[model samples]
Target: MSARLAPVDMTAFSPGRCARLIVKVGSALLVDPDGQVRRDWLKGLVADIAGRVRAGQQVAVVSSGAIALGARRLKLPKGGRASLEDAQAAAATGQIALSGVWAELLHGEGLTAAQILVTLDDLEDRRRYLNVSATLDRLLKLGVLPVINENDSVATEEIRFGDNDRLAARVASAAGADGVILLSDVDGLYDRNPTTHPDAVMIPVVEKLDARIESMADRGSASGMGSGGMVSKIEAARIATSAGAHLAIATGRIDHPLQALATTGHGTIFVASQGARARKAWLRGGLTAKGTIHIDAGAVEALRQGRSLLSAGATRVEGRFARGDLVVIAGPDGTQLARGLAEYDHVDAHRITGRRSEDLGTILGYAPRSALVHRSHMALL
Candidate 1:
């Protein structure tokens, strides 16, 4: 059985020290009863963000509401909930309308907000990752706000952020922002689920995240407006902080959630561990694998202890793979230990198993590369 846990403090997170911030607004805050866009709320939000921009703070907005807006606009058949496919379609339709609202509002403020839709793959590939980082860096440098969202229109079940909360956290880290603020319907995380436990206290701050805190989290939002809930939000915090950025979860009901989060104590703050390495964080948070490799126990220990996978440590390679395909690094026991792009195909890997690259020519009749997955291309799990 899972151990019982308490709540975290939210008021300790501050944004004053943050120069670049990522703010994710949930669907609950952006949609109304009519299932249409909430123009007034969006306008107010733009105004608030504009103030931050004027004050010399760079901001990235990760907004969610397109599906709800689209569902309402299209007036889909009466149903208790929107089908997953229906929701995806709605989001595609709503994105156009959503962007128009943002463009018009930001344009009126003499600021340009660029719409950037990305998928899991874009952030997974090192070259592509660097490319995106460069673009966001340039945008921030130029004083333009970037409005980022998942490429929901084209993403299939095989590849998705799964939700915007996770995506926002990733975006905050990808952009190298100073902090991430997740604005939701609730003010912060509770010690116990508030609905079931009347005496459940609201945690104010989390100095460190461990398995304990992760176990306390439940599933998706109870408000029914979005896919993310406390669990995903906490997962988001871990991602952001791992990327060397602070993360906060606060209520979107506040007039200026971002400013309040960055300045005063307004929500649950999850502090970063001491000097969490950036490269490892990118490996863990940025990349998604195309396949998996099963390595021996020795390989797992080496990778976990900050070493690379040697060709001799390989036990078996799984899936139809090509050179440079991102693959999972797992132990003999089948637990994922790391992720990296493969340097050879499955058949080639089988032939070269337990052999060093220098022996490739003599054993397999071909000269081989130095590493199965080069260190530069590898990321530990």
Candidate 2:
């Protein structure tokens, strides 16, 4: 028998990643109860974003403050949601200021900002989804930051996404972002309301969105903020992590909120899924691979890093499969790593092997898809 070793602590919290990130700023952080923008706090946040930019991380911001600003300007009710008509008027009047503020702040850090307003229907409809995705991809490629918000001025209830948290997750998925940070009033998910229960503990990381974990939501009005609560966050986590994006819920009340993500011991991270979502889960266990693509060591490393497989990285193609068919991703030595929906049919896939992404259109005489398999369409084994 060997000598016994010291037990290591496994419960401490540590922040991990973020390459391409989505940061959703709640109404409370940007606008005070009086409807004025918190310039200083926002300036600090922008500085943090600039830091991220310098570190080579791309970010998109989802902001929620139009209605709050609008409601205040109109002298709306004391304690509840405004009527649809009133809300529309408020959004129409307030959106200009909101957009201007974001533009001004981001520009201070030498970053260009683009405003994109959308309703739920834009994401649910396939054509609109592609359009939004393309626009976001283009903006990032051109080194511009995107600022997104709900188009409350015209969206009826049917197209309204209740909270920006969910919208951020949807947008993150579309942008192919790998991380989502929700800055909220509270630090993170807790067993109970920490204010009320002295013994309440914070859960630093959530590995699963099980019913047990979801039930910990405050369930109180607005969940705990102007529109979002623990409930909506849970839903958002399900969306982001399912797409293999790591999501963190941290407090925005402090100055330099984004910078505080790592040092602060007060946030919950929902780990990215490794074939956990239903679609990916199915791909991992239920599909029959109709073909295999032998990729070089470089491509294998990229796949391990959770990136989409580029055709240029493939050394050879084997078998036949159509676009959207399940195809195996293999190492040059023939070890299977993952399965994913093909973007090109077997004939086209074979023809494009070893070609640069930019040359795909020239070779195939069509608009080039950036990847042979998009990360969302893949499930790692």
Candidate 3:
């Protein structure tokens, strides 16, 4: 027989510990029974976001409600299933309204909002992933909050994320967010379906997503307005934890939902597998090495000391590889030291071998990064 897992400690779920956070607001929370946007509730949530920002924590929101809101404005049916064309039309109309509301609310709080629409392809394709990551990074640095959503207007079933739960997880990983809050109709995960089984108990904390834990997830949505259910949230938890972000599933129906999550312990917190260094997670396990860099003994020592790999320390570059390709770092004695994303291509690396950082612009004909592999992007073996 297996030993019982420890009960969740509600006091540990503090937002103050997180430097960056992503919150996913569901359609059910954003739209009411009459298919109207919950303006007052949204204002409350925005105020919570403002509080987080004032505390020096960067925050992003992944929101869903465009289709439902659009359906209402277009005089279409409110609750039933919608066709693909109907969804596309609703998204086109709803996206405008969604952006306007977010802008108005955020501006009122002395914050700027940037609208970002993406599909799964944007996160899956490496080039596009880099572009999106850079854009989000810049926005955060400029003290802007990004309002991201699926490109429902143009996305087909094949390319769609299907729901915002997994999209929020992907965004958390890409943005290097330390935490994710999934605001939903339900409070948190439970051992059984609470609505059907009156004796069901809420699970406040989950340290791992084992087989038994996964089995607790239900199939269909409890909230009639959304597509994702508890099962999708579980999947999102898996993705978020693996990417080194803690995930919290909480009730969005309450006023000031984010504030409630922080103070009331009103959610299930899924602890990350480790710390919030997603790039290191990717470097350690997510990618395959495309090439190798042979470095001197001095460079090996520097890397072991948690320093970046510089071109001056590189003795040789092997194999044809492009920028951002994962490469193995080999010591002079032919022992592999680490794996990391290459900042320059094989040709550029070969050209700059044994060169100093100040000479990189002259050698490469452009201002270049100071390191061949930034320490943040490297995983020492």
Q: Comparing 1 and 2 by lDDT, which wins?
A: 2
Candidate 3 lDDT at 147 equals 99
Model 3 TM-score (2 dp): 0.86
Which portions of model 1 show Cα errors greater than 4 Å? 1-13, 77-81, 262-264, 275-381
Residue 20 of candidate 3: its Cα lDDT?
A: 90
Q: After the best TM-score superposition of candidate 2, give how far the Cα of residue 205 lies from its true spot, in angstroms.
A: 1.6
Give all candidates' CA lDDT scores: 0.75, 0.81, 0.86
Q: What is the TM-score of each candidate against the true structure?
A: 0.69, 0.74, 0.86
RMSD in Å for candidate 3, one decimal? 4.3
Best by lDDT: 3
- Pairs that collide in candidate 2 are none
**Residue ranges of candidate 2 with Cα displaced over 4 Å:** 1-16, 78-80, 221-225, 275-381
lDDT of 3 by residue, 1-381 (tens): 001223346554567678899999999899887878899999999999999998999999999999878878886664433677788888899889988999999999999999999999999876576567767876887899999999999988889998999999999877878889999987788898887987777788899899999999998877778889999999999999998888999888789988877776767899888765543766777677889999999999999999989999999999999877889999999998999878789999999999999999999999787689877567887
Q: Name the TM-score of candidate 1.
A: 0.69
Candidate 1 vs candidate 2: the TM-score winner is: 2
Ranking by TM-score: 3, 2, 1
What digit string (tens of lDDT, one per residue) describes model 1 on residues 336-371? 877776767777877887887678878767766556
List RMSD in Å for every model shown: 10.2, 7.2, 4.3
lDDT of 3 at 105: 96
